[model samples]
Target: MKVSVQGVRGSIPTSGSQTTQFGGNTSCVTLMEDGRMIILDGGSGLQKVTLPDPEVKRVDILLTHFHLDHIQGLGFFSPLFDPDKEIHIWGPSSITHNLHSRLNRFLSPPLFPVLMRDLPCEIVLHDVSNSSFEIGPFTITSQFVIHPGATVGFRIKGKSAVFAYVPDHEPALGPKGLIFDKKWISGFELMEEADLLLHDGQFTTEQYGKKIGWGHSSMEDAIQLAEYVGVKRLLLTHHDPAHSDTKLNEILDALKSKHTGQLDFDLAREGMEIELG
Candidate 1:
């Protein structure tokens, strides 16, 4: 399996010298396994994704949540303008609305020039209520997470590896704050020795103190989860827009100082491509 970090920013986009190293575009990732292309989220970075082969016509996009930063790129996705393309979108449906209705509300009318119904390509929206499903060569299992709106974390299993993605997640905040003893995450099974875990480490310990319950996790929370699961590699993502490249480096430095040689982790950066076995 091959994974690429297309964007790493959280909430809003950023720019200037402070963001050049990591990137400014919001949540989006491209995953490839056995000649199949799968997109995780449709943030502004989705616009940067290109078809390596023009002959490949079908694409699958798995959305973790429908926040503006997550879905902002759908309107500008180039394939949507191609009549011959086939796009399938999957996400959790809110208690009040279905997936199609929620997406159409933003992708239509005064907000955007082209209505979703008028798109040239055939777009399918699947509302995920059950826990597991299959898409081509991958088997996906999702579960609701701790977020304000309906949100889910996904565990994607290819032929040889498993990848877990949690773009906007809050660590266990319930009264029982035990790490390993409690199943705080929705898709907990995905954490078991995952080849790569792309998780939300959007805030630092100090920032997290003030922003508790904001539907985001701190670096400490990410580290704890990775340590508990014993994942081969942990890649922290969903960077806060306010955190400059230097600040991010400081965070990395702090982690290095604490764990010594015990753990392997890294910060996910834009345009970073990696292969997983």
Candidate 2:
């Protein structure tokens, strides 16, 4: 399986010189192999996606939640306007609203110039919960996680590799902080023993102290979870919009200096690609 990072920033788009190296676009990632494409999230980085070959007739996008930073680029994704393409979107289901209704709140007039119903492509929306499904050659599991609203984390299994994504998790919200027992941890099943895990590392420990329930995790917390889950490699994503390239590097460097474990981990950067087997 091949994974590509299109956006790493969290909360809002922060395109500027200060964030050039790590990128300022919000959460989006792509997995491509054997002519199949699977997109995770639809943030401002959705605009950065290059369409797959014409032979690939369908593409599926799995969204974590309805947050603006996660779905803001749906209207700008060029392929959505292509009449010949077929697009499938899967998102966390709500008791009061279906997937289409929730998405319409953003793709309708006033919020967006075009309405969801007006898109030229054949768009299909699927409501997901604690379920498993398949798209092309990949098997996916989507489950609710500890985040604001109806957010979910995804576990994707290819022929030879596994990848887990949880870009807005706050599993350490309680006083105990990230229970060591896997059975009690949020999103633990999605990440356990995966080849690569991309997770939220949006705040520093100091910042997290002030925003306990903001649906984001500190870098330390992210690493701790990844280590506990025994993932082979960890990519810390969802960078705070306020963290500049220099500041990000400084924080990572400090963390690395104190880290003595053999775990392979690093901050996720836009355009970075990893081929897992």
Candidate 3:
């Protein structure tokens, strides 16, 4: 399987000398297994890729949520409106409506010039409820993450490799006076032993403290979870908009020093590609 990081920025896109190294595009990734394509998220980074014509083959898109930073590129994903291809979209249903309706609103006219009904390609929406299922030659498992809206972490297993993605999440917050819930711990367990674990590392410890309930985790929490889960390689993702490239590098260095010879890890960079056997 081949995994490509089309975009890795978090919260919003950025530009300037500060963001050059880490990049400023929002979250989006493409995974190719054999000849099939699977897209994760449709952040601003989707603008980086050329969408195939509807007459071409269809692809699968799995979304974590409908947050603006996460789904901002849906309208620009040209294939969605093409009549030739089929788009299979899977996502957790929101509290008020099913996954299909939520996505429909985004593609409807007014907000979007094109309505989903006019799209040439067939769009199939699936509301994911079970934790596991199989799609094509891959086995996929998911878990709910700590986020304001409904969000999910995905574990995809191909013939010989496994990839886990949890782009927006908060670390398990221990009991603090009256607040105590351990659900976040189970979310991390879903990524255990993954060949590649792409996690949310949107803040430093200090920043995270001020942003509690914002549904983001600190780099420290990400490192600890990677170590605990025995992931072969951890890719820090969902970078804070305020974090400059140099600052991000410094954080990487700090983490390397602590992990030493224990684990292989790196920051997720836009256009970075990984091939797993």
lDDT of every predicted structure (CA atoms): 0.86, 0.94, 0.81
TM-scores, all candidates, are 0.96, 0.99, 0.90
Query: Would you list the clashing residue pairs of candidate 2?
Result: none
Query: Model 1, 121-210: lDDT tens per residue?
Result: 999888885479998889998888777789988888999989999888886566554257545554467667889999999998789878
Per-residue lDDT of 207-262 in model 3, one digit per residue for the tens?
88888778888887787778777899999999999889999999888877876557
lDDT computed for candidate 3: 0.81
At residue 153, give the lDDT of candidate 2. Answer: 97
Tens digit of lDDT per residue, candidate 2, span 56-151? Answer: 668799999999999998899888998988999999999999999999999998999998988999998899999899998999999999998999
Error of 2 at 187 (Å): 0.7
Which wins on TM-score, candidate 1 or candidate 2?
2
Best first by TM-score, ranked: 2, 1, 3
lDDT of 1 at 201: 92
